[model samples]
Structure formats: structure tokens, C-alpha cells
Target: MNVVITPHTLQGTVEAPSSKSIGHRDLICAALADGESVVDNISPSQDIEATCQILQAFGADIQEIPSSHPGRAAYCVRGGLKRQDQPLSVNANESGSTLRFLIPVGILSGNTVTFHGQGRLAKRPLAPYYTIFDEKHIAYTTTDGALPLTVHGTLRPGRYALAGDVSSQFFTGLLMTLPLLSGDSHLQSTTPLESASYVNMTIDCLTQHGIQIDKDWNGSYHIPGNQQYRNGEYVVEGDYSQAAFWLSAGTLGKAICCTGLRPHSSQGDEVIVSIIRQMGGQIEGKTELTACPSLLEGRVIDVEDCPDLVPVLTVLATCSKGITRIINAGRVRLKECDRLHAIATELNKLGADVEEEPEGLIIHGVSGLTGGRVSGWNDHRIAMALAVASQRCSGTLVIEGAECVRKSYPEFWQDFASLGGIYRQED
Candidate 1:
């Protein structure tokens, strides 16, 4: 789908989308719970759907209760993951979180499980889990580090060691499964942890499910075994990653107020708020994240922990005064797309000067973008970031493959329209 967005000021307030990261974690725990779990504040998205479908296959009876919010719904999750007689075949779509978060659980019963993924998910590395499989004597086969991998082995209680820089999703999967074993387990990170906050989020979710995991300051996690998952009610928080686009829109145009966000969120993307403020974005209100039009000045941004913010923050950097340097973003190359390259390439098409680096970007801010045409790179964040970049453009911004927003924010276009965003369909 092509969207032609007129360079117009966006106004009015819009509710933030629910955090897909939190939604994935909470729902997984809910499915593992002993009883019915109510996880509210869910918004429809492809990635979330993948997780839901996989859980359903595990015997979780999930019912979606419709809500007045355009993209929001509540999921009542009952039943729990049960060992099936037949082999489990999981199609994870293009969601990396789903494929990684459920791998350990899928192999717990020694049932042969085949995981199929599409698009870039095939390219995403599952090496960490493969290492674990080798150590645990779990048999597995892969298509040369690609998808359609099969694993048939039992995961037992033991101390596991893996690199933390690859992705935190691996650690989350192990943390969720270790407690179900008959003996206690410990996890040690071989390298310095990146995206550590996400692991913290997993710990918190497990705690709510009546599971306990102890962590030392050195980043070692000690998970107790033989634990039960007890679930009650969990309210999903608003997403800062999605909110960053709208907040960046505010800095370039009219004041935009974003509601439904949690103050002091553990999600590392909350750093977006501080990134904007440091760049001279006019921001106020904690409960309601508000950003007003201001003269933005370029600053240094380190994305070592919050890689998801790179695309949107890159948009914000385009309109800043001085040079904006984004570093420690190498992991972003392994996301939905190479964000470092995609953002730099797409924005440069709109007349922004962005220099792509090996692991980062050096953006030379311009007065404004002389927009023409740009591609979404078939990546959701890339699509949304371009949409946010449109507000600073002088001409009509044409974005091809704009529908990619459905991956994490299905209501993104709706919320964009609600905020008086000027856009119309194009061929």
C-alpha cells in the first residue's frame, strides 16, 4: 500500500499503543499460569497474534474481549501449556520474539517440534539456543542457521551460559522454562548484557505469575525450580517505542499529547523521553507524555540498550540543529531490518543527510526535508519512522508499503488520523 501524506501539522491528543514487548511477556506467562489470567490493554498486531496462536496450540483457551479503544482488546487466557501426543509444529510468522520466547517451552517435552518462520526471521540467529541444545544433549537440525529448524530433546535443570549481546529474548525463554524444572538453575552471561531492561521486564512478569528468579549485581540469574505459575490480572502498559514517533512529530510541529503511558517504565525505550528533552524538544506531563514544537539541537545518542528507538530517534535527529551521532546500534542491524541502513537510506531520499556507519549513524541535520518518495523497507518501524519524518517535510511525502505498521501497531494509522494527521490513500 502507498500512502501520500501531505506535509501538515499534526494536532490533538492520541492514546499510545499498548507495549508489544510487555504484551508478549505477560501473555506467555498467562498461558503458563495455573488458572485463568486476564491481560488487558492489548492492541492487535501481527507479532502479538503469532504469540497468541502459538499459545492456543499449547492448550491455552484465549478469548478476546472487545474494547472501545480502536485497536485495544483484552485477552482472557485459560488452560496451560500441555505436552501433546503428536509433534508440535509452530509457524512463528515474522515475529522474532515469538520464535525465541517459545523455543525452550516447545522442546521441554522431548516431542519433536519444528519452527517455521518467514521473511527476515529465517535470517535471525538462533545460535544461542542451539548452543544450549548441544550442552543439554538436545537433538536439533537447522537449515544452515535459517528457519524450519527441528528440535527433539528434553531441557533439564542445569546452569546455562550464553552470550547476552545477541538478544535478551533467549534469556527470557530460559528464565521462563527453568523454574518448571525439578531442580534449581543458574544462568550466567558470557558477555556484557545488552537490552538488560527487557530481561528485567521478564523477571517482573514471572514474579507476577508467582515464579521467583533471583539476580545478582553481576547479572547472573538464579531461577528456582518446581515453581507454579499463578496468574490473576495484568494490565499491559503503553508502548514508548511506538510513542516515540508521535513525540518526535510534536517536536517538529504542533503540541501532541500522548496518553496511556506509564511513568518510570522498565521498558528501555522510555529513554526516548529523555532523548527528546536533551535534544531541546518541548516536553511536559509525566502521566500524559506531551511534546511541543521547539528548536531541536543535535546531541549524542547511545542505543546500546534501547535499539528499537533508533529509527524514530533518527527522525528526530534529522531536524535538530547540530550533528547527531547515534552509536552502539549494531544490534539494530538484526532487527526487522537493518535500521541503521534503512533509516539512513529512506530519510536521505527525503533530502535528509544521514551517513550510515558500520555500527551507527552520523546525521547532519538540515533545516527541513524536501520530501519526495520513500520506501518503508517492508519494516514496521521504518514505515512509522518515515511517517513521523513527514511532518517536517516541505512537499507531499509518499511512502510505499505503509501497511507494515500492522506488525506492532495495527492502529497506528488510525491513531495518526485521530491526531489530525493529514494523509490519504494512494495507488
Candidate 2:
């Protein structure tokens, strides 16, 4: 889909979407439990649907309960992953979390299982799992380090060593699966873990389901074997990643009041508030944040732990004064799109000065941007970033593939419209 946005200031309040990261972990844990579990405050984006579909294919009966609140629902999952005699095929669509998190769990079925993925997911790295498979002598085949892989051997519990610089999803996969093993297991990080907060979310969700994992500051995790998941109710908090767009809009235009966000959440992207403030934006209120525009000045930010923020941060940087340098964002290139390059290329079309680096981006802030046509790169964040950046555009900004926002924010356009953004859809 295409969209054209005219220069307009966003106003009014918007409730943040439920946290997709936490939702993924909660659903998986609930599925692993022995009885039915209820997960509340879930927004069914494409990625969440992927996880639910795969879990259902594994024999967990998942039912969605309609909520009075729009765009949010509750899910009841009948627990336990059933084993199949023949090779079970699972399609992950484009969700990286589902593919990575379910691979180890699939091994427990003791039957050959093949994993299929679509779009960039097929090209994303899976080397960490390969390392584990090789170490344990578990048989598996992959199209290089990418997807459409098959595995059949039993996963043994022992000391599993993984490079911390790799995607945290791999660590989370092991953390979720190792506890089900008959023997105790140790997870040793070969390097300092990036995106450590995501692991914390994983640990938090696991604990909620009666699993215990011990961790040291040195990046080692101990999982006791023969652990059972406890069934109960889990509520997913508001997503900071989605809230960053509106908070950024607050800096570019009128004040945006974002509600339903937990200030003390473990989401690493929660750092968006501090980063905006550091760049000279104003944030007020507690449970509901009111971000008011200020004279934003560019500052250096390290995105090692918050790669998802790079796209929106680039938009914020474009409207600030001075230079904004984002470092340690090399991993972002492996996301749904090469985000650093995508942001630099797409935003530059709108007259923003952005330079892409091997591991990051250097953005020279301008007083305002000139509107032009841009591509979403089929990335949801990129699409949303372009839309938010449109607030300060001198002319109309056109975005191709704006529909990509449905990947994570199905109601993004609706919310954008509700915030007084002037936009129209096109064929």
C-alpha cells in the first residue's frame, strides 16, 4: 500500500500497544505448561499470529477472547507440545522470535521437524543453533545458516556455550528449552551479551510460569532440569518500541500523550524516553507520558541493546540540532531490513542528511526536512518512522509499502489518523 502525508502536527492521546516481546515469551511458556493458561492484553499482529499458529500446530489449543478495548485480546492456551510420528512442518512466516524460540522446543518432540520461513527470515542467521546442534551431535540440515531447516536428534542438556553478540533470541530459545531437559544445563556466554534486557524479559516470563533460572553478572545462566511450567494468567505490558514513534512525534510536532506504558518495564527500548530527553525533548507524567516538543539537540547514542530504536531515532535525530551518532548498531542490518541503510536511504530522499556506517549511522540534524517519496523497505519500523518524520516535512511525503506496519501495528494507520495526522491511502 502507498500513503501520502501532508504537513500536520500530531495531537491527542494514544494508548501504547501491548508488548510483542513479552507476549511471545508468555505464550510460549503458557504452551509449555501442563494446563490451560490465559494471557491478557495481547494485540494480534502478524508476528504474534505466527507464534500462535506454530504452537497450535504443536498441539496447544489457543483461543482468542475478544476484549472491550480495541486492538487487544486475551488468549487461552491449552498447554503441552504434542509429539508426532512423522516429520512435523511449521511455518514461521516472517517472525524471527517464533522461528528461533520454537526450534529447540521442536527437538523435544523426538521426531523430525522442518521449519519454514518467509521473506528475510529465511536469510537471517541461525548459526547459534547450529553450534548447539554440532556440540550435541544432533542431526540437522539447513540452507546454509538460513531457514527451511530440518532437525531430528534429541537435544541433550549440558553446558551450552553461545556468543553473546549473536541475536538474543538464540539465548532465549535455549533458556526456554533447557529447563525441560532431564539433566541440569548451563548456558555460558562467550562474550558480553548485547540486548541483555530481552533475556531478562525471557527470565521474567519463565519465572512467572514456575521455572527458575540462575544468572550471574558474568553472563552465565543455570537452568535446573526436569522443571515444569505452572499454568496461570499473565498480562503483557505496553510496548515501548511502538510508543517511541509517538514520543518522537511529540518532539517533532504537538505534545503526544501516550498511555498504558509501564515506566519500570524491562523492555530495553524503554530507553527511548531517556534518549529523547538527552536530545533535549521534554517528557512529563507517570503512567501516561506526555512528550512535548523542545529544542532537540543531537547526541551520541549506543544502540547495542536497543537496535529496534534505530529507525525512529534516526527520524528524531533528523529534526534535532547538531550531529547524532548511533553506534553499535551493526546487528540491525540483519533485521527485517538493513535498517541503518534503509533509514539513511529512505530518509535522505526527504532531504535529511544521514550517512550510513558499517556498524551505525551519523545523522546531521536539519531545522526541517523537504518532503519527497520514500520506500518503507517493507519494514514496519521504517514505515512508521517515515510517517512520524512527515510531521516536519515542508511538503507532502509519499511512502510506498506503508501497509508493512501491519506486521507489528495493525492499527498504526488508524492511530496515526486519530492523532490528527493528515494522510490518505493510495493504490
Query: Which candidate's lDDT is highest?
Result: 2
Per-residue accuracy of model 2 over 124-202 as CA lDDT, tens digit each: 9998889889989999998777779999888788899988897999999999989999999999988889999999989
> How accurate locally, in lDDT, is each candidate?
0.89, 0.91
Model 1: worst 10 consecutive residues (lDDT sum): 65-74
Superposition TM-score, candidate 1 onto the true structure? 0.98
Clash pairs, model 1 backbone: none
Residue 110, candidate 2: how far off, in angstroms?
2.5
> Which stretches of candidate 2 lie above 4 Å from their native place?
none
Which of the numbered candidates is closest to the native, going by highest TM-score? 2
Worst 10 residues of 2 by lDDT: 65-74
